[model samples]
Each structure stands twice: as C-alpha cells, then as structure tokens.
Target: MATPTQVPGWIAVDWGTSNLRVWALDDRANILAETQSPLGMNAIAGDEKLSFEGVLISLIDAWLPSDARGVPVVICGMAGARQGWLEAPYCDVPARPSDLAQGAVQPNVRDPRILVSILPGLCQRDDADVMRGEETQLVGFMDAHPGFAGWVCLPGTHSKWARVSNGEISGFRTYMSGEVFALLSQNSILRHSVKEGWDDGAFADAVRAAKVQPASFLHSLFTVRARALVARDGAAVAPGGAVLSGTVIGAEIADVLGLLQPGEEIALIGAGKLASLYQAALGVHGHKATPMDGTAITLAGLTQAYHTLKTASERI
Candidate 1:
C-alpha cells in the first residue's frame, strides 16, 4: 500500500448506465491514476434491494487507493439521480458548469472525511426532455472553445442538438435517431432486410433520396426489405447495403438541418465512427462538422465540476 504522501489530491468520477470511470488527480489537476469497471447503473438497477450507497462503497473500495481514502471526490452523470445515491435536482436550460456545481448533491455516507459531490443534469421546459450525461460534454466543449457561439450535435442513444451562446447552453432538442436505428437494425424486421457491409455509393444514394423526399422517410424505411427481396433474392444488400440503411437515418437528420440558420456551425460528439457518419450526413446538408470523443468530454466535465466545487468551497 502507498503512504499518505502518495495519495491523490482529488478523485473524479463519471458513473453512467453501463460503466464506471474514475480518475485520481493531483492538486495541479493532472491525472495520476485511472480505473473503470462494469458497475454501471444497469447492474445496480438489476438489484433494487441493495441501497445505491452500498453498491457505490463496494465499487469505490475495489478501485480507489487505500492511501487516498479521505481525498475529496466529485461525480457527474446518473449517480446523482433520484434512483441513485442522492437526488441532485435538475438545472434548467441555458445552464453553465457553475450552475451544475452549485447544485451538487452531497450524500451522507460512512466516510465523513471524504467530500463527495454529484453534479445535476440539465433540463429544458421548452424541449420537454432531460439530458443527464450530455450536459457534461457541453461543459467540456465550452472549456475547449471558450468563446464559441453556435450549435452542437451530440449523437448517441439519444442524439441532442444544443445551441450554446457564450458559455451557457441556451436551448436544445433530443432526437431518438440513434435508438431508432439500433432497434431497427438489431431487433426489428430490418435486421434481416439489409446486407452486412457498407457501400458509400448506396449510402450517398439513400441520403439523396431522404434529403429530397423526407416525407417519405417512413415509407422508404420499409422499402429496404422490398429492394433486398427483389434485387438480391431476399438477401441483404450487397457490400453497399449498409449505406442504404444510413440513408434512411440521414434523411431524418436532413429534415432537422432545415431548422438551423445558414452558417451555423455544428459540432459532433461521440465515438469516431458514429461522429464520422453524422459528419457525412451533415456535410450533405451543407453544414461544417467537428468531432470530439465522448469519453474525453465526460472526463473534462467531471474535472471542471471538481474545480467548480473547490472554488465554491473556498468562497464559502
């Protein structure tokens, strides 16, 4: 075991639905250690009899340094929900990193010396939706682009398109495109309807179809099966078949793109492949796209939350 001298200055955590990410940082904000585990909300939700605090303690004990037992820790994401350890209430839209930090929920745990603060998620009355983890990504984006003013597209299970001005998240909308795609490709009849591989030409063709005839999105989706049946003997599309699948989704994105003002910049946040696909779709609609890794932004947001908490404490 390491001595007290080796203990980290602080701990940052991004606990979400399927994974737990922890980072041990020094006073200067450099990460000295990092760990991840499968103790996500899904695992905890599966065992409702166990209090969330108990599950968290077990997970933290397995990962945190013994010497760093009493270090301050800050957390972001679902860990702050009503179903989680403590209820960190939601902050309304046009929120800032400081707003979330100020709304941190401090849970009463066995380790009294360990300071733990959970950041709140973002909600907008206008949008009639809520975003828990994505707000952290927006915080990190603001950190990277200090004076940026434009729209950001965070494509994921629930894709979010946010409008940011100065450093605050002004407005946003969530689309179920990613989740819809997942369901159609994996669970719905469409699974067996398309070929296994992607073809750029076919994808571009579908994109074009969707863009021109967006009202046909639902109609065009089902036709993929008909196309495979007639053209490929009921087999999925050949090598370029995946592109056809993308076209249907790309068409939906094209419809949304019409709402944006001309010259508005768009930033895509997610894994590289998904971001690239969205970039391609956005390009087809004549919008410039920038991509950032979702994980990096989450970590950066957690770090920003920690700093915000530390500053608030100092002020108090």
Candidate 2:
C-alpha cells in the first residue's frame, strides 16, 4: 500500500462532477501536498447524501493525523451542488466574487479530523444563468486584475462571457459553443470530415463568414460535410476541426459582441489549446484579449476564499 503524504494546516478542494482534487496548504498558503480522485459526484459509491461524504472520507482519510481536530478544508465546485455533498446556495450577481466565502456551507459528517466548507455558486436571475466552479475562477481573475472592468471570456466545454466591474460580476452569459463543436466533431458526421492541425487561413475565413452571416452558420457547417464526402482530397478534410471551431466560436462572438463596449478588450481566462484558440478567434475582431492562466486563477481564488474563511473564523 502507498503511504499518504503528510497533511498540512488546511486543505483546498475543487470537487466537480467528474473528479475532485485536494491540495494540502501550510499556514502561509504554500502547497505541501496535492491529490485527486475520480470518485466525483457522478461516480460516488451511493446516493448523494451517502456517497459524497463516503468518497470524501475515503480520499482523505489517510491524510489526517491521529490527533488532528477539525482540519479546515475549503472547497468549491459542483461538489456543493444540490445533489452533491451539500448545496451551497447560489449568490446573486453584482456581488464581489470574494464574498463567496460568506455563502459557504458545512456538511454534517461524523469525522472529527475534517471540517469542510463549500463555497456557493453565482447566479444571474434575469439571464437565468448560473455558474459553480467558474465563479471562483472569476474571483481569482479579479484578484489578479484589481478594479478590472470589461468582458471576461472563459472558453471551455461551456464558454462563459462575464462582465466584471470593480471586482464584482455585473452579468454574464454561457455558450454551448465548445459543446457544439465537440458534438459535431466527435458525435456528429463532422468527426469523420474534419482532421486535426489548424489552417489559419481557413479558420479566419470561417470566422468572418459566421460572424457576418450568423444566420447561415448551419449552412457553413454543412459545407464541411459536403466537402469531405464529395472530394476525398479536398478543403474540408484538413481544416474541418478548425473551421467547425471557428464557425461556432465566431457566431458566438458575433452574437455576444453587443455585450462588449466599442474597442473594449477581453480578459481571456483559460489555459492551453482553448486559450490560444480564443485568442486567435478574438483577434479576428481586432479586439485585444489578455490571457490569464486557468490553473493559477483557481489557486488564487481558492486561497482568497480560504483566507476569507480564516478571517471570519478568527473573528468569532
């Protein structure tokens, strides 16, 4: 059996639907140890109530020292969903992202070695939009860019466009553009049509086409299919992935353009491929986008929340 790494003063967790990660942090906020599990909410051992605590206990049981008393664990993500460990209700927008700590919840568990606090998600009532883990990222981003005010685009499976003003999120919208691309490329016929490796020219042209003729966006998608099937050695085979991504993202960007101010720049918070793709796409509009690392933002946000909780606890 593998021995568990030594525990630290506190734990930071980002538990989502598919997985959960925990970082043991010293009092000074430096990471001492980190681990994760595939036993997320979706793959728990039992019902919502039983599974979360059970899986959580299983994951961190070895980390707790025998004499430890209520080791603080600050967590955020879908683990606090209605059906997860405990529902840390949604906090309405136009509120400081750092204030998420105020909405944290403590799940009732028999274990004395752990005290878990789950941060609340954010909601925009008017838009019928809600976000869980992303709010923490926003807080981290805001922490990095104090007094930042503008459109913040977080591209992923479900891309988010949030308006951050004075450290608070005024409003936001979620797009299924990434999911659309995935479905088209992986599940739909386009998967067979488009190969990897980007063609910048093709991507740029598709972006322009979709942005200008948003209504014909579906027609452009169909073109990829037709080109691939009709011509074996053709335009569609090489640049299918890029074109599909460009077309969907372009339409999304064009649609969301109204949310942006004239010549206003965007804060693109993401990492790796998604970040580069968004930067390239946003560049097409002549709009400047500043890139922020997703992992760094998560750490910053969690640290902020951990401190806020620490402060509150100290006050009491």
Candidate maximizing TM-score:
2
List, residue by residue over 1-316, the lDDT tens digit for candidate 2. Answer: 1333566788888887888887777778777767788877777634545577677767677777878889998888998888777899999988786569899999887888888899999998996998999889888888888867788898988889889887788888999998888899889878876766779877877888887897898788998777666776644454787788888888888888756776555889887887887888889987778678887688789888988898899999
Runs in model 1 with CA error above 4 Å? 1-5, 48-51, 59-70, 230-244
Question: What is the alpha-carbon lDDT of model 1 when measured against the actual structure?
Answer: 0.75
In angstroms, give how far residue 215 of model 1 lies from its true place. Answer: 2.6
The global C-alpha lDDT for each of the candidates, from Candidate 1 onward, is 0.75, 0.82
What is the per-residue lDDT of model 1 for residues 226-279, given as tens digits with 9 covering 90 to 100?
676678556545443465456655766776677667656678887777788787
Best by lDDT: 2
Which pairs clash (backbone N, Cα, C closer than 3 Å) in model 1? 194-236, 195-236, 195-237, 199-240
Please report the TM-score between candidate 1 and the true structure.
0.88
**How many clashing pairs in candidate 1?**
4
